[model samples]
Target: MANNRNTSFLSDPALLEKVDKLRDLNIGQHVPLPQLVVVGDQSSGKSSLLESLTGIPFPKDQSLCTRYATQITSRRGDVDRVDIRIIAGPHASEEHRQHVEAFRMPTPSGLKFRQDFANILQKANEKMGLRADVSMANGTVFSEDVLKIEVQGPDEDYLTIIDVPGIFRTTTEGTTKDDMVMVRDLVTGYIKDERTIILAVLPSNVDVATQEILELAEDYDKDGRRTLGILTKPDLVLEHGAQAAVCDLIQGKKRPLTLGYFLVRNRGPNLESEDQSELDQIFRTQPWISLPQDRMGIPALKEQLGSLLFEITQREYPKLLQDVSSQISKCRRDLDSLGPSRQDEREQRSFLTHIAGVFQDRARAALMADYNSDSVFDQVQLRLITHVVNITDLFSAEFQQSAHLRHFQNPELHEPAEETVSSGEDFQGSNSLGLTISNLQDLLQATGVNDITQEELAELGEIIDLSHETTLPSDDVTSWIRDTYLNTRGMDLGTFNANVIATTFSEQSRKWGDMTKVYMSRVIVTIHRFIATTLRSVFPEEQSRRHLWSSILDGLLQRYKMAMDQASLLIEVERHKNPYTLNRQFADALSKARGHRITELLRPKARKDTRQYGELQNMVNLDDIAKAAEGKSNMEQQQEEIHDIVRAYYQLALDRFIDNIFQLAVDYSLLHGPDSPLKVFTQEWVINLEPEQLERIVGESKVAKKRRLKLAKKIQDLSSALKILKI
Candidate 1:
């Protein structure tokens, strides 16, 4: 039946591709026979079963027998013939090969070739009664070297047997560092293959050791396929009624038992003979399997195993095939998308332009809301100076009252005036000195200073003296005063104020202005720095956002690739000479062809020359507006350019956002087989822009006409991009 199916399937190219996909996904492998892994307690008749099945004696003793995992394989032509090989380890190297020779005694020494050398070491450890710790440290543990052996039966069927360590017995010594390392490596290595089935052997009688083995197995079996329980030492249970009671207890407790118990005697020569009557009588006349005597039972067990193997193969293959095909298809799609096609370039440009516009719009709104007022530039400067003077006065007064400065007098308030007795050079310098004093007074008044009365000035002098006279340090007072002043007044300052002031005036001509600019700059810069630095420190949200976006993009891309690949494969398969190989080839072909046509239609196209020329003309008109705005006063130019940049960015970003929304809506419709919430939203969407808002953004305040024109051109370009993207 399998041969007929293969012949038919392979004849069709499309069917062949599907089969290839399955193969790539490791899904469809022709497994004719099932492999059995036998594991148990050290003296639980495990070796006896191995001997019974393979007709080969396995060494049995109490001192840690089966030190290494053994594999038994049947000879290719002879179903009844078997071969054994040991998995190699670090110590199985040539240098240590001789040390293992003693264990393979009685077996042919010719088998001690390089290929068999590792097995010799394992066998030696088993026979020599090496402690698990020593063997493990020396790296001679059997679990570390899982064995594989194939057994060919007379019926042309083969059984591959894996003999692993009786974990129940091995772990009895208590977990050591070496044991843990070895166990970890063993479990990892054993379970690495999803197809590998685990068979756990347990005594028929219930015990704490058996429970522990089951628990350990459960912990390590990720797919839950490999761990199976095999009840051994059934003969012991038959001989003693207590054993039957133990089995009853275990069964009552609901212990997981996959395979039924095998009744076998390990210590006697009549092991091959069936004693069914005696075994039945011992177990109160219940049906039970008697090993060696129950030869017919072995074939039954093999048949059961064959069924399981077939089921697993069928379950895993198709899925694997589907996954591999999907991955390949996705890669092809991505390559196509990334190519320098005019459509792709147009799409990318459109997307970028949309994004830029959205940013510009948001920035424009923020700036307008923050900076829109009548004569705001001049008002901001005047307000800043007034705030600084008030803060300084308050701080000075606080410092004078502070305990640390109690001993010092204020020089400005207490110093005696110099007598004006002019010498020949002094007479000429008086005019310049008088002018300087008058100018300083005018500047102080402009900063909102009121005339200080002589009596109030004397009171201020007394307070300063009191502050200096105190025992506390002056540094504390200075710090406190500075903090109080900055905190109360500097908190309201904007980041651009100082830069604006500096740009407005020269350093030499306006000493007070420069001082004000420097101080305000420090304040604004410090506040902005604090906000930025604190956000980064407190919330790694930016990094998290990036990671989230990347993951989302990856998942979306993967799904897209899969769909494309499946579509492509579907198309390829329909073109086959023998379409009937797959039952649904015609339907798949039509669906895929329709999808491809739609995708082609959706592909973007670059703008035409006429459209480009129209956009350029719009841009030129906007540029003229900007140039006219730019020739105005410095303050006007700044405002106009700032407004233009902000608006342009906002428009660009908005366009991109709209485009994305539309794309998402389309994808949603495809996924759900109809329009979804996203589709509905896209359909109802409108880009709302208020004229009032735009006017607020480009304030009515006077700005250079040239700057306005420049800004207008940028806005036009941004709008053109948005139109192109249809956002």
Candidate 2:
């Protein structure tokens, strides 16, 4: 066996072998890999440096000066073997990718690497769609496809190295402007990876400051921390009169680097020992002898590069582990989102049934205000009960503000209107109304009636403010009512006709239909949004969700229409039906309104008689009050009574309208009713679905299938990578 000491000289063979396995797992394509990459201008001895480090001869033709990136990984094993493959680019066509994957080179006996490797590379080039015989104008000169070479033997040292396309400033006959930009971009991209240790190869004959690779290295690694400068072609140093600057670079007196520089000369196909002797002899005679001995030869350069790569890998191990774990988690989530394959009726039905179960559970929970059902329900938008309640409250308030056709004011009772304070101005003309709602208690003091509760007074106040802007003046209302009563009067004689009361109430409440229609439409829209959001979460697949939505849409629309029709019917009953209420609150409201009006009329007389009677109520006795009320014409008093009846009926109907619209129409028809939207997709419903219908609702699309397959492969590769990392 080869000496174990040789393997230990570079890095732990065990660790490098694990890294080799990681590379073979192909995880680097997704994340940055810990490796060394050699970059330089064209014809700058990049291949030569790679050959010296790995003891493998690469093709010397300038035409192959990195038509594609090359990844060389060396490992120790029982049998000497060399295997080559191509990793297709992310955007490579499926047909071309298949060809690239199937490409193989037959290893000759004894592994004559130098003699046959050139033919292997040519075959790979052609496989990548690049042909030497084709001109640049006719064929692609470069490929993003990576050519990977694995060499394993008992004598091999463990290492991984990559050679990217050389950076060039100008394009030649075989290259175009696009090719120049492509090569530059490729090289910069490789060095930009923080985990990669840059091997910046520069010819000794070139001006070190003018080298593009050094500029690029500085651009990515400004402190020169991960960069190692390698000076090649030292034989041409004296002939090109570049010795002074080259010696300055070697001595680290100019353009200093943290890892510093290495001076190496190509071995030119000679034996390793002979090449070492010749390189040592060349450096021993001149100013090069003063250069550090540790930085002068290929053997020393290899040790530095191996140790640096080891240090970087050790430093970046945690990050690599985190990256792989994160990728695994992401791939798993993607796979879960795609759900299982649904190629047949059984699978489709199974998947959809599961979805329906979850959907029904969540929807039921939201409707019942049981938000603890799932984490998704924690969001306010998903709290269906709260959303509905809030909308209902807003509707109630707006209807109160905008429902009335005209507000009543007593034109007969003359009194000073006190200034009224209001919180909001949404109700118009309320401030200027003759009666100030806040002072109602003061006026009622003389009536000796305190039966009206604070809640009742507040309700009355709100109605008064909202009705301040009247569509008809008080006299006009009284005139209309008197005329209506006279025309519709029957043989009832002294009593006003019932038809007059109903017609007056109906005319005042005409705004109910339009307002209720808008409210129902809003409720329908809200229900639709909630259902759509729920289905999206359940189905995940766009096509499946769409089909399911279309299937259920007809039922939802029908239910919504029913709810709207119900609301319209309620409005019609309020607007045209007979005005009647058995609730005692209506009588109480009527009495309170009458007392307020009577007090206003009696205030002027009461103040004048205060000197004679000592108190207002004591001065105005019942018979005296009756004789004063007899002063007005009978028709005017009846008209006043008509106005009060309509006002009381309006307040009563407003409450009923609000309740009927929300509970009977919205809640019953759209939310929790028998045919409500919440009940559209049930376990029984899904069970009753035909096989073809189930497939249509839950079938996996081709795009989804393709994505699922892709994610599965990614997860497999990442899992293998994790296992190797753990090892």
Candidate 3:
């Protein structure tokens, strides 16, 4: 009854053939295929079991043990046919693939097919360059490549099993410790795949704990959900009085598995018959018969494996289709990024021309401030015009804050104050100097200068902030200016020498050149970033992009240096050239400055007490005003006038300097001119390149070629798989 039940669902041709077609397409190499993989230690009857399942002869001797993974597939067909081939390993070079592909054997039929199987394997071994003896040390002892065999006959069952090299403990002749590790890694590689159902074959005569395959299965499938334990050679265990232990394992009393265990008796050296009756007869005789009847024969093992494979194939088919589709999309996308191949000079030039055209358009857009065109422009740093304007504004504001050598403060005032006179203010009369001073009407009225207006004081404060202003304090600046005025007093009396003021102005503006260089560097960096981003988008391949950069960057940098030199020369001329301005605003600025300073000096003489004057108006002291100017000489007043002239000229120069740095240096050298950096990689430049230069810049790399071929093959195989799956 048990035998009849086991043979009923042993083969399902329709479903199994679909999977066979997928495997034949080599889909398993890229993605895991639903199948059973047989694993065991050496001398564990693993080969005999495969022979029982496939009816093809496997080498039974220890010397001819499997040196690589063998994929044996048997299914029903009208005529008997046997085909063999090698699937190259991942690391196999092109030369090795050719050798593997060249291995062939003559077609044989009937009894002759079985007879030629061993010769076919021997030829395959030689083709793989495996050594014959452990001590030879000439050829590799193991390979990662796989040997695939397909057998078709009317009587065959629909089954596929991958048999890996049996695990071995110690090294033998011609084999070293490396071979052991290689074999272990090779076996574990197949068993660890989640899609494969592991078939662990163990010899019942040996202790089950000693079997390496079982340990590996436990490591990979700890819950034993997809692992099946097969105990072979129950007859040998009977002689050792270990039948009870084997029975315990079969009955789930020890080392139990979710899929349970099965006991099978295989053919001995003297017994060459392959039959389930022989196995049944031996189990019926004694203690073996006391084990579970349903789990004791080869037929039950085959039945269980068939059901498991069918179930897994059905469950994993949808996911397998999705995986194949995903791989196809990824491969095609990678190929697209590589662009079309260019083997010759004309093709290389054409490809480079296309890239250069794209670069030109992007750079033009950036220069024009049209940032809506490309996605790369989404980064704020890459927006050329906006960033340049922002940094330039910051440069101008910083110069306004720190350009002065010293900040002047009136010593008589309660708080430190800056002159707040506006250029629009009107002055009526002239003082002792040649400057027109405001508030002469009040001086003539003998009330000194009237109270300073809020509107007048707010004008200079609007242009520059006073709270965070940076410079030397009043005491240091006054002493320095006074000492210089006395030392340079040549042919002048009651006034400061003009050279002292000129020399002071030159020293105060020394920081402009260094600041301009830093500004230019920032602009260069921005241009380079935009160029690099354009290159990445145009040439997705790294090697080609690097070559093109080398070809064009020298010209761009030379232009930058030329412009930089011109800019530095402009600074040199400005520093050494006489301080002169043709603009008429300088006089108005100086007059307002004098009015503010004289008002501050006169305010100390006004009486703030309401008893002396009214609440809004202040009474002036003529004696206090004389003490404010001088008792014997007018040198302090001369120093005050000199300080006012320098302040007015510095403001005029700062405005002109900022404009020159942006327009003359950055715009002309890097962005706008015919030979500017933006014009370095135009289509005309590509056409002008010498043939050798074109090849040097655009030649395809070996790694890129290999990658293109790999992706192309992967896309082809996956497309075929999709068709086979009927998706």
Candidate 4:
């Protein structure tokens, strides 16, 4: 075996200088580039093969000579020879420089272009040899240097040949294994581009068609063409009489192999003439191998590589086009099968109305049951009466001690004017009405009751008696409480009953309202998100879901918060407690249950009374509502008015649960993009399901085989629909 300590192209100073120039030039930008990766078992002639191919013998010391990845390129004008450059990890940089410098000293012949490289390395080595032992922060010791060669052929096609450390030796050390994995990934990444080809070199004694090699060959063959394999030390095979057997193995078992193997003898002047003739015959049989006896093996291999490279380049063009076309076709298909159109929206509204009616019927039945069992309203009245009596008892002493109440007992109360304001100014309103009532109560307290006349006292007594007579008994507080809180709450909860009925009713009502709004908004937003973001991610489009979602969420939240705040302030002024504030707090709690935003709570409700009007408007096929108002068209005006009313109703509903609706929109977008194949399939299934089956699936019930069968039928229907749409 060769001493394995031999250093060749890596030591060439001229090549090193050329590598620097290539790096500075940035040749990676050029088109039709080739990445040539060299892979083999340790001491299996990987570097030797690269040296032979690139006309630059790489160092082959038993100690790892190549560590990390490296790149070598020729100077732009120089096509005949290459420049060597090293690519090392951050930790290996200093050590690699030293090795590169040491190799450059006493550069070999025919490396005239790398004269500057030789001087630079010599100078660097002499100055920094001591610092080479200085380790990087990472634990990895810089020991090996990978040699990269960039060859520019006469055709101006650039080929990058990477000479990696052998894989087998890497397993011996944990660190080495890590390095090997990284190197493998790097090599794989380069080769996966489809423009690159891997050249695997095997020793003559080793089997040419080992299972491992076959697997490697298959992986390397992106275009289904076996990588070129070289059988080095052909003379050894000739002496062992294994040449015919090797040939049989390669030709018969590895029948699909792209390039045939060649027998190469590395021995220089000592090789015999008879041996040379035998080598020539072997070369003749494997015309793919370029091995010249007169010249160094480097030139011959380079020539052969150039031809092989040209063939690979020709194949890549068509393949790239095919990949692009396939992607475009997929994008077109996705665009055709997206969510609800105008017709779909109308149908969905109708469906919602039907569902609402069902829920209302259930709610009325539950209410009747409560009514039959001492009625919620009656209980509420009794409770209010008891509360009034309790309040009177609590403040009875204060009422009796007030002399101002006695004097003001018969005082006339003035009402506000009934005439409408006809001023040009807009209506200005305040909470003064409540303040005025409070002031009147305060006046009665300040005055002494002894100042009042007997007639006035009799009138006050009669008023008090009337109030007490109108109030219900304390025993009926339950019915009154039910009327005030539970009935209002039960409007949405349907037949559900529990203790703390009012609180439960309120909570359920708020939850359902938010959920419904969120779901509806989510469906719409999901479609938008798919169109705006998801499709772009999958189809190489401009916009992304992340960007779209971020923008939409930011904008929607800002607007919704502002609107809610204003609405809350108005409600607080009118009702003495901020409704919007309470709604927001409720929404926050509801979101915890749903684990999502509740933006859908803001969607406007369609008017039930305007169903006929909506149907008539739909028949008119108005493209734009604004256009309908032009030319004094009464029907168009009426249609516009109806639309405005619908919009107002929608706005009111949305105002009640904006957070939920917005959240739903975001969720919908995330779930229905082009990249969301699962979501798309799910949506398709939902759209195709029978009405009853869909209801069951969406409802709380869990039916197994029936559900599965229904789901399967839905999928089938969706598939048929998609087929019709050519999606």
Candidate 5:
């Protein structure tokens, strides 16, 4: 490594050009670029100082000219020539762009410093719509773009400067609120760069308290370490007792900066602009500046800046490489996350297909209830299962006790049944309640009594109350109880028809539609979820893809909603179909209930029948015992059949409806529908996309693409620069 202490080594042209190239690529806005940044309020001799440094009479008009950031860079070269260029900004107007483009193209005529450049700047204002007589009420001025001027002459100091727009207290005739803000932001953009050293220029003639640059500098660099205060227009400090204050300011007695201050005299407007030697002689004549010759002249400031920048560069050059590498890695990672650039048809095809396959795998997993998988739709599957289970369990419990199965529950209807007196003397009177099931086989052979009357069943529900006459034996007591229930067995007269069954389950089965809504919501949610996650991951620029996905999903979501509505409609249609309990296990349930009740009632401890061999067993009279047994048997059988019918009907109907409807929902719609997100792509759809449409889908915004390209180039350039650095 060369000794950085040597002035020649510190001022190496190659070393300084690395940062300049980054500036050209415009990487400074993102990653900090090491340079001297000049900032001051309007009329603070900012432009004069830059002109003195670069030896160019840059336009001094604040409103019409020099309103953009100007980068003046000088490198050591024998041919004293100037290279000028404009880096157009994202918001640059037509006028500014035209001028920039014209400047970029080669002219048949050789580059003329005076006329051609002046024409460009003037025409630029015209393009920006700045009036010859500018005013603020209807102001339209744009373009915060940079104008770069490079001067390379023999033994030129390797100094790079960022001269930004001047700050103003108030907008004048031509300037608006935006103009005021634009200038400040433009200046702040440069100074806020951590790697750039702030050259805070303030007129010595004005009070330093009013300077806006230092206030802004303090915001970004609070310690005032990177800030160097330059007191321009020192000649204007000839007022009453201002020279003493200026001298104190220069000597660091007031408003102290870490690098202190420099008092440089820009040539007064009336005087011919003096050369470097002439300025030195002029500065020596000044009372305030002559005392501190080392810190009062333009030459001294150049030396200080060169040393300062060199030291900063030497310290930060390695970090610059690291910063570039870090940004590059970030951009690449983001690009990778966007998957890949779907620029061509083939890439687009592959990108869309990959996303589709991923969505399909996830959707299939969800459908199969594979919650154990780490697929995106695992939670959806779990939630869906929970919903189905909960709804089915509730619906099953409800269906069992439905009103339509009431007669089935209580076997013999006991209300006003058809009454008839048989020709045979065995039949009851015409006015008797429902037909008696006094003899089961006879009722089955009927006096036309297929169903026992509700009246008869109610009448028979009564049990004869018996007192245990004179403390009879337990056998006698049990026998009496058995005989009582036997005499009052239930009778039913109402016919079990489709209307009765419909009334029973209509309310319960009506809720099948509600279940549709609930399950449909889950289905819709999962579908939407798949689309959202898939589309969101397709591109790094969420904003770019949002419009396209939103358009696609708008119609899709509407269709899905309609499909779900139709599902509800189909369920409603299913509800309107006459309810019927078909081929239910009525006989089996009746037999099971009868046996269960009879066994429960006639258990050994509770029975009153005489024992065959045990003498210790309690015995009732044989005739009474027979009557007791017959009575209990009849009562038990009648109740059993009713319980059996209700149980069978409930179980069958409940199972069928839930299984049929829920299975239909699971199979038919969302798992497959609004065409399923997986099948939403085609070769031509992704491939032959219009540019405008592609912009909505995956194409990068022009500004963002430009920024990425700039960063990528900067990385390449910085990597090349890193090769030149020995350390």
Candidate 6:
């Protein structure tokens, strides 16, 4: 019971202020406010029930029916009068503001009610600009505008309800079929709000299953989650001998909803002549009413509704925090987009600085690999220092260890200054001897010498080449014979293979260049979007912001191209020629690898080579030596040499390439290439502006201004609501 006492806290006047103010701010739009939505067929005692609840003297003229939704929101106040305040639809441009002010209905201090409800309705219709316009057949026949009736008194319950205009089955004289659709649509709109508790008022004279509103309610709330049934004409049920079924409905039987039905014999046409006390007495003691005191009459009805509202409020108050928070966040973004509303140039300059500093902070965070931010929109696909650096490291490791790199031309080895010419054409441990043999062959081919007779001519030619070579030792003679034998057979063996390795390596490494371009594009786009979004926010005026954006966008693009070209200029030097790289470690690694492969290939023929070569003197043909060569073309040996040379330098060039790529990406696309977003928004003279101009010249249009005010006010109202609902 003590825990149940918390319900009284919801009825606090502070909560009422929050609800009332929020209602006025959104004007029944945007955020869905919690309330009861009363639905019934036309003249089904909907108005009579509202009049009974409020104890207000509503007009008896049934002709002046409710044309729009009448939202009844009341709290316990000292005043005995009803405040009739009209909240026009958003589309009712002319009357929205004027009608929002409360029209107080004063009554003398007595049980006698004021008979001026008709005049008030007439005034409401006139204010809505709907005088006699119901008959006009222009298809847009109705409005979502609501007339709010606020009754404040110590005796009255603190409750909120929306009594929508009755559903119509047939077209009236002045109205077409559209009016029937209009009223239903209007009713459905209020009932559809999940925050609303549906009070479906079905007359007892009609079958509940046949009502279209009942079907609609069932569809919205399957198994009756938030719907409460109200049997308005209980007398008709008793007189017609259907009290047992009606009582079953009231006692939670047929069409059972989560909240069971309540029965009430409405004070119908004579509602204004009676007070709430008389109606209460009739409901408790009158046999004609024929309902239990707990489930019937205005008093029980008030208690049930109040308890239901408290239940709804308690269930949904936590969501109020979320709703208000979301609304505040959304409005803040919109308002930020509209930029700081500067009173003059000084504030405008300050605003520009603030936005610039904010962007700078975000960019620095991105550079430093901090991606977290308050704004949901503030995000990057990859941090410059995180993913890019990781990718760079990956590239370097893979490239350095690539199989394509066999070796490189060693700087440690050099060509001799002179060549030795002799019969002993020694090439053992000598880099220069190969050239001496080359000259001998050149002479033989050039002089047209051939056969045994030309063998002397070859000697003569070779001796002539002797002057070009230095002397050699007798021990080297054997080595020279083997060298001459090997050289005469083939020359320039591996030249083509080495050229191919260089070309392939050149081609493969260039792919990273294209990837660098793609990475740069992402960075540029991230910064570009950030600039446009943030700068547009500061300018506030759409037209001028767009114009400024377009102007600066062109300049930034041009600068981007220039920045890319500048970065490429540095990379272009490396692209044109391979670096003169000297990697000593790669030389040792390549030699060992090539030797291992050769040992594997030649191991099978080692025994045969030793036997055949040992018996070389008795050999009948050159086939033994030829076979001993074992496919070792001068071209292949040269190819192996070139492969080793290329392999050694591969790592050095790759490391340099990767480093250059990172530097280029950071410098050209991220830092000061096209002037960072932050710098672009806050710079000397601030681009496209004169010296005296403090900010971008822009205009705040009428519509933009209105939207700004509405959002701000709505935010204010929600802020209050959230504060009150915090408990």
Q: What TM-score does each of the candidates earn? A: 0.34, 0.75, 0.77, 0.36, 0.65, 0.55
- lDDT by residue (43-93, candidate 1, tens digit) is 656776665444445655434466555655432242243333433343343
Clashes of each: 68, 0, 5, 60, 19, 20
Please give the range of 10 consecutive residues that has the lowest summed lDDT in model 3. Answer: 420-429
Candidates, ranked, TM-score: 3, 2, 5, 6, 4, 1
The most accurate candidate by lDDT is 2
Question: In model 3, how large is the Cα lDDT of residue 523?
Answer: 60
Better of 3 and 5 by TM-score: 3
What TM value does model 1 have? 0.34
Identify the superior model by lDDT, candidate 2 or candidate 5.
Answer: 2
Q: Which stretches of candidate 2 lie over 4 Å from their true place?
A: 1-11, 90-97, 108-111, 133-138, 239-241, 268-276, 333-362, 371-478, 490-498, 518-558, 577-663, 680-710
RMSD vs true structure, all candidates: 32.6, 9.4, 11.2, 28.8, 15.2, 17.5
- Misplaced by over 4 Å in model 1 are 1-36, 62-64, 68-71, 75-146, 150-156, 168-177, 184-196, 205-211, 218-228, 238-240, 243-297, 320-727
Q: Model 3 over residues 385-424: C-alpha lDDT tens digits?
A: 7666545554554455444455543333445455322211
- lDDT values for all models: 0.36, 0.74, 0.73, 0.37, 0.58, 0.57
Candidates 1 and 5, the one with greater TM-score: 5
User: What TM-score number comes out for model 2?
Assistant: 0.75
Candidate 2 local lDDT, 1-727, one digit each (tens)? 1133344535466666666677665577776888899998878888888888887677667776678888898776788888888887656666887889888886742268656877788788888889664254566998878888888888876678988988888877777899888878777767888998999999998888888889999999989988989999888777525787887777778898888889998765444456555765777857788777888888778777777777778778889889999999999988987888788888887787888899988888988989877888755556777667655654564566556655554433456232211111233322233333223324333222223346334422221112222122222455577787788777764568878888888876767666676566555655666677788777777878889888887777677778888888888888888888899988997897788777666655652345655754435556556655657776777777887788777778888888888888988888888989778877788888998898778877778777877888889989998988887
Q: Rank the candidates by lDDT, best first.
A: 2, 3, 5, 6, 4, 1
Q: List the residue pairs that clash in candidate 2.
A: none
Among all windows of 10 consecutive residues in model 5, the one with the lowest summed lDDT is 464-473
